[model samples]
Target: MTSAVTGRRRLMGAGLGAVAAALAGCSGRSGPVPRLRLATGPQGGPYNAFGRALARAVAESGGRLEVVPVATAASVDNLRRLDEGSVDLALSMADAAEDAALGREPFARRAPVTALARVYVNYTHLLVPAAGPARSVADLAGRPLAAGAAGSGVQVLAGRLLGAAGLTGGPAPADERQLGLAESAAALRAGTVDAVFWSGGVPTPALTDLARELPLRFLPLDGYAGALRERYGPVYTAVTLPAGAYGLTGPVGTIGVGNYLLAREDVAVSPAGELLRVLFDRRRDLLREVTAGVRLEPRFAISTGAVPLHPGAAAYYRSVYG
Candidate 1:
C-alpha cells in the first residue's frame, strides 16, 4: 500500500500553487471548495466503483475539493461528456480514446480530451451458458447477443471482434442488444441472450457474482488480439484470465485493453493536480472498492499511449520522474 511514487523537491516547472496543492492533498478542506464532476460507468461496473471510491476518499480527507461521480455508459460515453464539458473528469478505455482522438468510425471528428493516468487493463469477457450449444464466437452467428451498452467501449470492441468473426453484416447476423453489464447479466439469466460481451477488470464483481450463481463459460478471444492490434494499434494485448478467476476451473484467453483516467482539454491545472496527488497518495483506499486500482502506479500510470496527458498530469509525472 506504500506509494512507489517518490517526488523530488523540484516543482517540474508547474505553477507553484498547483504543485503545492497536489503535494499537500489529503488534508481536510476548510470551507468552500471547487466542485468537479467525474464520469464513470454504469452501476455494478469498475468505473462506477472507482469513481465513488475516489469521491469518498476526497471527502474523508476533508479536502477543499469535491468530486462527484456521474454514471454513464462508460468509455466512449465518458469521452463525449468530457468533450461537451458536462464532466470534468472521465474513465475511458485507451482504444476508444484513441478512436475518438483520431476521428475513427463511431467518432466523425477528433475529440479534445486528454489523459490523467493509465489506470488498469480491462479483460474482455464473452460469456455464454455453460451447457449452451454455442461454444465459440462463430457459433453465435444467428443467436441473440448483448453487444454492450450504447456508446460504450465494450460495444465498440465487441462490434469489431464480431465483424472479424463474420458474425455481423452476414446472412444471419447476431441479433444485438445494447445492454450494460448488469442488464446483460440479467438478460443472460433470463435466457433472453445467448452470449454477453463484457470488457472490464478481471473478477468484475457483477461477473463474479453471475458466475457463482449460474454456470457460465468464457469463450476464447485469443485469436483476435493480433488482428485488432494490426488493424488498430498496440492498444490491444493478448492476455489470459487465469484459472480460479470467477471460480472457473480453466483459463480463458482474451483481449486486454488499457483503461485510462481522462480530462477535457480545458480542465484547469489546480483541480487536475489536486486529483492526481490524491490518487497516488490514497490509492490503497481506492482498492477497497475497485481491486483493479491495485495495479495503478506512477510509472504505469504515465503510459497512456496515443492519448496526450493533461498539463497537470504531465507536471505530476515530471515531479515523480525527477
Candidate 2:
C-alpha cells in the first residue's frame, strides 16, 4: 500500500485499540462510550478539517468517546446547532460565541454554551486584485465585493468592517456580494468581484492557491481595530501578519478574533474531560493534519474570554497542571 494508505491503516489500528480500552473502562459504573456530535464548518474550511482531526485523535486515545464531525456554516450555525441541542460540541468564533451568550442579533435569546478552550486566532483578510483600484477597504466602496455567506460569521465581520469604513446602506458605493470562501476566490479571479473579505488562519490554503493564479494584495484592517473593539468588545485585537506569510511583500496588519471550542453547559463532565485529554494526548497526530492545530497549546487554551469554561475542560486543565 502507498504511504498515505499505510498511515490511515495505522491510525485505524490505534483507534480500534482505544475503543477496546474504552469498553473496558466502562465495565463498571459508567455504562459505555459517550457518543457526541461535533459541529464543524463547510468542507475544505479550517473548522471542518480541525474537527475531523480532533475526532481522529479522540478515537485514537483509548477514550470512551464517539465524536461525530458535522459540517455546517461555521461559527453562527455551529452555535445555533449547539443551542438547539442538535450537536454536543462545536467550534465557534469568539465574537459569535459572545453574541450568542448575550442574546445578540442572529440569536433570538441567550444560549447555554460554555467554552472548552480558546484554540486559535482567525485573522481578517481583505484580499484585493494586485492591479485593482482598491488600496484599502475604503477604496472598495462603489466596487463589487464578495463578503462571506449570508448567515456566516464572515458576513457579520464583513458588515462590521464596512460599518467601520462609514459605508452603511447607500453611503458606500459598492455591490455587496455574499459568497463562501472558494466561491469568493473564484469570483475575484474571474474579475467578477473586486475584493473579498475572509477571516481565517494565516496561510489559508484557498487564498494561497488563488495568489498563485493571480497577483493579489492584502489590505490592512489595523486602522479599524480600535473602533471595532470599542464597538464590539474585547474579542477584536490588532495583529501583524508576518512578511512572506502567503507570499505577501511585507508584514501586514489585521484584526484577529480568538476561536473557541465550545460545548453545551449540560454536557457530561467525564466525557468532555476525556475529549479534551484525547486532544492534547494525540497532539502530534492532529498537528500532522492541520497547521492550525498547533494553536491548541494548554496555556493559551484556558484564556477563553467572556465564555465560561466547561466543568470537564476545567477538570482536564487541573489534571494536567496540578
Candidate 3:
C-alpha cells in the first residue's frame, strides 16, 4: 500500500509538470503581428481621411497599427520618408511614385519604395474668382495664382501645366503664391490672388465653400490634356468634374492622377497582407467614413505602374480578385 501511494504521488507530480509545460509553451508563443506607423498628409487633406479609415480597418482586423498624421508636402515628401525608413507606410500620388522609383523629377536618385495599392484619382482644379479676367489657363498670364504650398505635389504639377501652356515666364508672367488650400481660398476672396491651382478629390470643402459663397469659374484644361499625358506619360489622364460635384455651374475638364498607398521594402509580408485584407474587407465601412475612400475599388488598386506592389498586398489582391 505504501509503495502504491508513493507511485500515485509521483504520477500526479509528473502530470502537473506536463500541464504546466504545455501552458508555458502556449504562453510563450504568440500570433505573428507587427506594429505599423502610417504617414499621412496635412491635417485636412484627403490623405488624412484615407489614413484614418485605414487605421480603423486595421484595428478592427486585430492588427496593431498606429496612423501618424504627418504634415508633408504630399507625394514627394511621402517617398522621401519611405526611402529613409522614417515611415513604415505613406500615401503618395502615382506620378510622384513613378518619378521617385525611376529617379526622375525631384528624386535625385531612385527611391526604394514599393506600393501597397492605388487608392483614388485626384483632379487638377484651376479655380478663379467669378469676376476675374482669367477665363482660361491662358488668361492667367501676368496674374497672381496660388500654385499650392512649396515642395508639394500640387506645386510640381501646377508648374508643369503652367509651363506647358506657355504661361510660366512672359512679359506679364504669372506669379505663383505658395499657400495652403485654406490660405489660397482666402487670397482669392480678398482679391489678392487671381486664380488658384488645386489637385484633389471632388467636394473639396474649401473650394466648395468658396463656390457657394461667391461666383467661381473652373477653367477647362481641354487642349492641354493630351499634351500633358504625352509629356508626363500614362500617369496623367483627362478627368471631368461633373456639374454638381462642387456646385459648379457646369462640368469642367481637367487632368488628374491616381493616389496610392506605399510601404518600405523591409516590412514583413504577413502584416502587409493583413493590412490590405482589413482595408478591402471593410471597404464599404471605409467609404462611408470618408467620401474620398468611396472610390477605392479592387480594379483601381491593382492599376499602379510607377511603383511595384508589395508582395503581401499583391497576394491579397490576387486572392480576392483572381
Off by over 4 Å in 1: 1-32, 291-294
Give the clashing pairs for model 3.
142-172
lDDT of each: 0.82, 0.81, 0.74
TM-score for model 3?
A: 0.86
| Global CA lDDT computed for model 3 | 0.74
TM-score of each: 0.88, 0.88, 0.86
User: What does candidate 2's lDDT look like per residue over 1-322, in tens digits?
Assistant: 4442353233334443344443333324466678999999998888889999898877776667889999999999999999999999999989999899778888999999988878778888998989977788878877889989765788888888898886666666667898999999999999999999898877787888899988989998999999988987878999987788778879999999888999999997778777877777765556444443245666788776667777666656655564
lDDT of 2 at 311: 62
Question: Could you tell me the TM-score of candidate 1?
Answer: 0.88
Candidate 3 lDDT for residue 259: 83
- Weakest ten-residue segment in model 1 by summed lDDT: 1-10
The weakest ten consecutive residues by lDDT in model 3 span 19-28
Mind giving the per-residue lDDT tens digits that candidate 1 earns over 200-294?
87778888889888899999998998889989888999999989988789898999998899988887766677788788888656756775324
